[model samples]
Target: MGAEQIRRWESGALAHAVSDPFGQGPLPWLRGSENYFDDTGQVVPWYADPALARSTDGGTRTADDVHRQIKGFISTGAAAPGEAVDFHITVDPPQQFSVDIYRIGHYGGDGAAQITTSPRLSGIVQPPPLTADRTVSCHHWWQSWRLQIPSYWSIGAYVAVLTTVDGYRSHIPFTVRDDQSADLLLVLPDITWQAYNLYPEDGRTGASLYHAWDEQGCLLGEEDAAVTVSFDRPYAGAGLPLHVGHAYDFIRWAERYGYDIAYADTRDLHAGRVDPARYRGLVFPGHDEYWSVPMRRTVERARDGGTSLVFLSANTMYWQVSLSPSPSGVPDRLLTCRKRRGPGKPALWREIDRPEQQLLGIQYAGRVLDPHPLVVRNAEHWLWEATGAGEGDELDGLVAGEADRYFPRTPLPEHESRILLAHSPYPDSEGVKRHQETSVYRAPSGAIVFSSGTFAWSPALDRPGHVDPRIQRATANLLDRICKRD
Candidate 1:
């Protein structure tokens, strides 16, 4: 079948299969209807469904089954190794569980390596209950555990695996970062993950920044939707947000190819802690939509200072979001934005007289939901060096999902050269046909910025045998030169 036919089939199957975080075919439905919060403020949904557990079977089944029901998240999604972080958990039956922390990297192709294990702790578990509106809030819970990250932990994506005596497992992912510099800095879009996460375990409240469904099953406007999503909640579906596909895929590829990569959360950019000058290249991976003013300025300054940027993402730096402290006063823990709110609320970066195109050399053209072929425009460009992709050659499915197009509002930065690389056309979510552009530009500072202009680009690397190898070779070409540059 053609790429378009395959995309139509895959998108449909993924819609139902997307919400399973554990790679399980489907999620277990909560048996309870009435759920009330305990004095500690934890939402308990399992309380109403007492018979949901098959305890009568006893032995291994009961022990093993209880662990599968455990779900939880950290108070702050990202923290330093020396800092202490709180973990909130929900369990069917309160029991002692061990926490195993693993740093996710290109570790021998496994992508994760166990770092440390915590002593078994006796604790009570809180289950999310249905709200008065019958919608679920899994984050309404008390602190279940706290761990002071050891000073020896490496900076990267870390998953705290909760395990019971019966070997049931679940994961809460976080990042550990430091001030030390490296060759390449990978900024994971954790904000985007939490923004789209609605913990759609029962398929009831999978609302996000762009979309939401009301109690009556009616879709609500962005302003009326959940304006603020907390990082204290677990992510919806596979726990790997749509953005993660590209972010992790890039990380795995870079590591396997021997790139000296460091890790940081996007919030680090907002807080002014990330020193872009320390790295030759900065990578922004997948669905990086929301941005704080400081974050934009930091990157803008870095670009001017010769830090090459690789935005393997789409619709990035699109919305302007503000950050506030959580109830715990942890900075950048809650992301707040009203995409459809009035002008008095918050405006997009464009409304504030700054467009992302000014830096990215491209603008948000439109979205492409159906799969389409990426048509190479400049095969002679250095990026297409070894891909064997000729001018006008079609690369199937690399341009699927949201995309950006070359639309420089102002004259190019002095001495900068922008090259249009690919042009792909497709119908969007509304069936309106549109086109997106992929480009690369050289800045005056000798720094180069390349944008794949599609959210699907990164994740496309993970598909075995089906994805085009040209994309991989093109990525390696960018990283090899950028990271090795003076």
Candidate 2:
């Protein structure tokens, strides 16, 4: 096994190594390398061991660089349906490796097109260590995995392995036959079920001006808001750590943006319920703070299989969930809770509580960005133009709206710049200003996104502030970007 999707070896190739705003930078000096991509679109450098390798974009990519470019497993041949395939491996043992496999859509496919996955693909116990020459010393033994390959409905996904231990890194890749089983994976809860679909059962609170739903999305409520009109109708509630009017605003904005969406029932997926791929992307809408291992694994496989992701969320990959069935088949009847043992270690299992900033360029401070609306001054910032809005030159008018001052996320990172979309602060007066602020991330995956904080643009559309022409055009532009193919 080797470092695969989202995993980065410490390939020392950055222009510089900067400290994190909150956490410590990775230990072990990053190694050096010259970029030379293999046939599979994977970049292979001379060094197998790298202490500073990072995902080209804002993700955790090892030397393998699986996040930006999925590496290939086979050479000298292609895979076809119903064929017998052999997956060969050369490892630097002492460093263990394991992989979760998936087969995605065709090369020219749009979004996540994967169709096959080794849902239960066995992983490695150790990966090989790196040698001095920057080459992963191939273990003397030949390890192989067999699958009755499926067509993948497209081309095969190069087997993606996460290095469980440390080892000498290598450029050698592995392959799987086409006849194997792969599921066009769709992640849990958010995959099919939106927060609106969530109904609170403990006689939940009323839908106040603060939120559309009385409760968060993960709860199995009785008043599911699913629609029969279209997937673009209403996506889900605002992400989490609820802000005033956030959920309604998010849905309203989603409808305006024309974001096609759905979610898997918190109760359903927890009951050991799984589905093949349904939606192409498993978006973490907004403010999602909790997580489940099964839920996370499904998403991991989905991404590896080539599903495009829009983690329009903050404070993600944080909690764990379990399936507690009431012996009923209803989605709502299923019981879901934040891992009781707390965080990652479930009552029944040990799970991953991955750091959010590593996966998403921006980190959630457990504190909001600004208590008051602030003017965005990063005029030359690239994100302002990510949705083609160009730079936010209109900040003068926005700031002129009698806004309070703004706050910063301590020391922000330079590699991933941050831009303000909207903000709010406790006014000097009794007036509590609520403005939706959003930011955009032009991810390394080429996914153009708008992370709106003042999500009310959608809900506000029909109201006075909602009718801001600047808001309308800007939001519409972002929606179009989201729905557009390629």
Candidate 3:
């Protein structure tokens, strides 16, 4: 088969495997590509509306006429164990419903096994009144159920399985985290997910940062785009909860290997709830394109304090955002940002004199529609230690998506060594071919930061797929030394 044909097959197989949360068998394509790689990374598809059927477009629903007779969302998007959380429900036709909570994580060969289950709480769903935004309000729905998280609950991602009598179901996602420390911190980009959630409430076009409303209904531009998105609504699509394609891949892989890790939302960094000094390293996985002032400052401080970082995805920290409290006074429930509207607004953090290149050792180069070659440079670097990679060796299919490039900015970070590990070329938005770089550097604070500079990094860890063993070993190498440090 031709190269293009091979990539298409591989991409389809990977997508198929990841879209299933109940853990199906591996896709038959590219079998034995890696003898050592395991295929336990399948995740349940997280939909914005679990009641809606998945549309062919991937991000939208298949049946627009389908109305959810019963649906609800959690009072909070995240909470700690022993904390009582309320699940507000709205049942159409006045029916009975029940909820079962499950903690999502890797359990052996299957992806995302329901590690824990809570006692089902039954209730009657009532109609909810529309809010000022024309969306459903939890207030009128006096029919709500509560669940006190068990102290034994692990720190990670969770989903509440909401089922109505006679077999209708939906899911509500939340994070279970606390003020603990670990060898590594995995920050989930929940903000990015909420920003893109076009939950079709009130029958207008789906509302999200990328869309706006019109006289005819919802349109696909920023003209009527919501500058502020609330976490109060349910996510649309297969509910492949956000970051499943991006960050969750790494989480699954890391768990398979038993990495010493802790999970938290990126908001924790912005709110100063995370102590970076407690961990040897912080990992930003796939499409981490937004940041707040305090979040950036905290990481910079952590770097100076000897904590390392790894950016396993591209186009990171490209925009700046501000967080506000929800009606409940829960901090970070509302994320605010006005993109492409100019200065005085929350412009790209780079426009505010803080380019991400200064921190990432690379800049947002652009994205790729076609595949690119990941050419190894200076393979002698310790990162290429075990898998036997060499200078100028091309690792196929490793830089096929969004990519970054090395561009030293003013006020450069104090680094002892900066090395380009891989150079991948692809066409930019203008159709002009350009190369992206993956780099590693060490700061004077004894902190080392590695940038994969491509969105393909995490996917390279899955198997019977497009994974490269060399890349996996290289990743393990970085984690080993970083975690071993004092």
Candidate 4:
């Protein structure tokens, strides 16, 4: 009758050769939509829980749930040397989906091995039009993967794809395994702080306002318009980890450019939780100040094992968290071994509980209120040096705000740390002669770290050309370097 809707645009289409064998077509939707896209530039949407099931309605996945999901996926089936598996999906509209890929810690606390599985997609996604609309029938593929065991991974699992728009979703999971594989792991808890319950205004008046996990969490997308809120609860991830701020933007940014989000939370690294030996590399996003002993051990182990650690946050391993679980749900307390501050100018992480500051080459010091963006003391540095990213190295421009400042250690990030960019805060044009420690450093073990004294910096995934391309780019590069390592 009519053309295969997918050929509407690329009419000079080829024969329905039973297979996109050539990867051809105007494709179904506007974009050359596919069930999977882990290509160099496509961003793999990370999830707070990659094991989310389609059985629940936006089911709440806790750290335990995520941990189980991880373990389950890894010790699964094995793929042939050069063989790969794929699935097909169908969706409706007004819905967007996210597929997360991650590895489960294979052992107990402190010495876990990264259990690799097939790279099967997680999260909700759209089904093929052929299946959804009954247009043709079902979407064809090789296999639908599931963990064959719980502690013996022979391949890698990847959240192949996730797509949602309107109210429809298409999700697919797949796998690829070889002698060498770079499976995703929950490396650290560098808080994304992207979600919060904005309602019950009174209850959350001073409850540490975090970034909304999504621009669309409520029926009424905007935060203000939403009636109730969903805070204090375990607000999971979007199958995508962000560097510092808004994740979706970075998701889009990574889609446009290139970056891989290797993330983890305190819960994922706790006592019977994640093992650190599984991964060949590790990553710490910006403002990953809140960490637990387990999380710390994981990163440190990765570094000690010669696995590169990319520390892309202004402050790294400053605080520690504990996984206090609850059957009623995850409202576990997040205690800062270091001092914790609240709503105020220069929100500082007091030194009340910090014994690890020395390790990061920084100690909790002072606070700065809504300060103004001032010139970094060394704008001519390499991060901004036109030749390199000196001036804007770690921070492209001035931090400009009353941020809680810290009395940083002289040889920050460590003598073994390679410094990248540096900047300071100021009052007037003369630039208050104080330095606010904004620099990028790499440890001797090839562990790269970046720091910004404040905690409001978000990556530029969505805002690529924003003022601080350095924050995002530097972070991306650091992660890339880690990912590229052996």
Supply candidate 2's per-residue lDDT for 137: 19
Q: Rank the candidates by TM-score, best first.
A: 3, 1, 4, 2
Better of 1 and 4 by TM-score: 1
Q: Residue 205 CA error for candidate 1 (Å)? A: 6.7
Whole-model lDDT per candidate: 0.66, 0.31, 0.67, 0.33
The candidate, 1 or 2, that scores higher on TM-score is 1
Q: Residue 404 lDDT in model 2?
A: 16
> Over the stretch 1-486, how does candidate 1's per-residue lDDT look in tens digits?
222122211321144232221111211211122233333343332212223121223211211111325667787756787998788866556677777776655766465567877888765656553332322344568887888988987778777766555434455678888877788999988877677655543323545564544544444545555777666565553343544545656766677777788888888888888999999989996668888889889998888899999998778898888888766676776777767665574457766668778878787776665567888998998899989999999888767666788764543444368788998777777888788889788889989888888766776564333346888888888888897742
Best by the TM-score measure = 3
Using lDDT as the measure, the top candidate is 3
For model 3, residues 65-108, the per-residue Cα lDDT tens digits are 02545566676656788997777765554565556565544566
Q: Measured by C-alpha RMSD in angstroms, how accurate is candidate 4?
A: 15.7
The reply for model 1, stretches above 4 Å from the true place, is: 1-68, 127-140, 164-169, 200-207, 211-213, 217-223, 343-346, 408-415, 429-432
Candidate 2 vs candidate 3: the TM-score winner is 3
User: Lowest-lDDT window of 10 residues in candidate 4?
Assistant: 129-138
lDDT of 3 at 398: 79
| Better lDDT candidate (3, 4) | 3
* C-alpha TM-scores of all predictions: 0.80, 0.36, 0.81, 0.45
Q: In model 3, which regions exceed 4 Å deviation?
A: 1-66, 118-143, 201-205, 213-218, 342-346, 408-411
lDDT of 4 at 15: 19
